[model samples]
Target: MSTVLELSDVTVTRSGTTILDQVSWKVDSSERWVILGPNGAGKTTMLQVAAALMHPSLGTADVLGQRIGSVDLFELRPRIGFASTAMARRVPASESVIDVVLTAAYSVTGRWNEQYEELDVRRASRVLAEWKLSHLEQRRFGELSDGEQKRVQIARAVMTDPELLLLDEPAASLDLGAREELLQLLGGYASSPYAPGIIMVTHHVEEIPPGFTHALLLDQGKVAAAGPIGEVITSEVLSGTFGLPLTVDETDGRFTARAADR
Candidate 1:
């Protein structure tokens, strides 16, 4: 499979605090990768580089075959989809559901004077339907439940049929029912052959969707293990990655983890 993202010795320093340290990773077009780490592991920072929103302080980042810092990011960014709480917070509370997804074509949150054509409207409708939000087309964005808002954010991300999809804590704060519902839909999307290369950042193993093919564990902003999901998510790897003794279990394509018996 072709590589959608390639990072080599990338480092990000913010006010003398280094977030990522000499990190190297690759994401292929056919892979669904889950980035696992405790808070401050630089998961979100890494995703920013991948999304063309942040430039590394050291080393090189190549996204979508174009090396960052050498290409026009405005053109490069549209090819990649990104959904996160930060992006969600930027959406206007009064924006309609359909407009929230439609405005993504122009990479804007709240619609201004930009004009859209019939084809764009049709595409937005199709994306909303795909994400099961067609019925909520006219609803205000802020009026949706947390789960529904998350779905709308994802729908907006995929509206342009991006090649690389980045999700940052898509299931972060939801009740059990909402989390399960979102996971069910996310699992189906990840399993689709038409879906883009997916990279999700989540702290809980339980939040991982079923169809994810690979895992990347990070500790202190460095890669602890990276490989196929089964191989990298072993008890030993996870224990080390989280700096605690833990046991990992899998059943029916889902996973769970807990502290090791004392």
Candidate 2:
């Protein structure tokens, strides 16, 4: 499979402090990866680099075969599907659900006076149906439940049929049932051969969708371990990444982690 993302010794510095330190990683078109790390561990930074939203202070980042510094991000960004709280904040609260997904075709947060073709409208409806948001098409974006809003955001992200999908903390702030429902939806999407390469940043192991193929553990802005999910998401790695003793368990391809006994 072709490489979707490649980060070679990528580093990001802010205010004279390093945010991401010499992070080297690669993602291929056939793999679905979960990024696990505590807050400030550079998970978001990594996604930002992959999404072409931020250029690294040092080293190289290549997304979809285009070098970061050498390419026009406007051309690159359209090929990448990115969903994050930051992106959500830019959406007009009163935007209708269908419009939310439809506007993605133009890479805008709100629908303007631009005329949409019939094909675009059809595509938006299909995406919403895929995410189980068809029933809420007329509802205002802000009126939906948290889980519904997240699903809508994801639908909007994928509406343009991107080659690489980046989701930062997709399940953050969700209740148990809501998180599980979203994970199940994500699992179904990830299992599809037609789905794009996916990189999801999440704090809780339980938030990982079932069909995700690999895991990357980040700590102190560095990769602690990265490989198959079974190998990279061990108790020791989780403990080290979180800077605390953690007990981890996996059953039926789902994972859970918690503080280890004292």
Candidate 3:
């Protein structure tokens, strides 16, 4: 299978503090990966590198078959979709849901004076409808609930038909019902043949969707485990990654993790 993301001995440093250390991993086109790590474990930093937003200070990073420094990021970015809480804050609140999603075609967070083609509008509508956001097409982005906003962001991310989709803590700050609903949607997307090679960062194992095939466990800027989900997401790896005794469970293709009894 063709690789969508490839990192070899990747290292990221800020102010002489290593955020990611010699991490190496790959996501093939046919697999969906879930990144599991506690806070400050550099999960977001890894996604930023995969999204091509941050270049590694050392080693090679390839995204969508394009090497980071060698490719024009401006041109490469459009082919990679990213959804994160940080990105949500950057998008204008007053923008309409449909407009917010459509602007992604031009790689902008907000609408501009440029005319949008009918085809693009249809495509945006289709994606929103798939995510059950068609009813809120005319609503302002900020007026929606947290769940609604997340769906809109996801719609916006997929608007460009990217080859790789990076989701950073997408289920964060959501209520139980909303999170489950979103998880179901994500599971459906993961099983779809047309879906992009997905990599989601989350702290909770319960948030992992059913079709996620691989796992990457990060601990203090280092990889504790990386491989098939069944192997890497075991209790032992989870315990080591979190620096605490933990038990992992998988039932009906959904995962759950909890601290072991003392």
Q: Rate the local accuracy (lDDT) of all candidates.
A: 0.94, 0.94, 0.93
Writing each residue's lDDT as its tens digit, candidate 1 over 1-262 gives 7999999999999999999999999999999999999899999998899999999999999999999999999899989999999999999999999999999999999999999999999999998998889999999999999999999999999999999999999999989999998899899999999888999999999999999999998888888889999998889999988889999999988899999999
Q: Provide the global lDDT of candidate 1 against the true structure.
A: 0.94
Kindly list the per-residue Cα lDDT of model 2 for residues 40-91, writing each as its tens digit.
Answer: 8899899999999999999999999999999988998999999998998899
Clashing residue pairs, backbone N/CA/C < 3 A, model 3: none
Off by over 4 Å in 3: none
* TM-score between candidate 2 and the true structure: 0.98
The number of clashing residue pairs in model 1 is 0
RMSD in Å for all candidates = 0.8, 0.9, 0.8
lDDT for each residue of candidate 3 in 129-216, tens digit (9 for 90 to 100): 9999999999999899999998889989999889999999899999999999999999999999889899999989999999999999
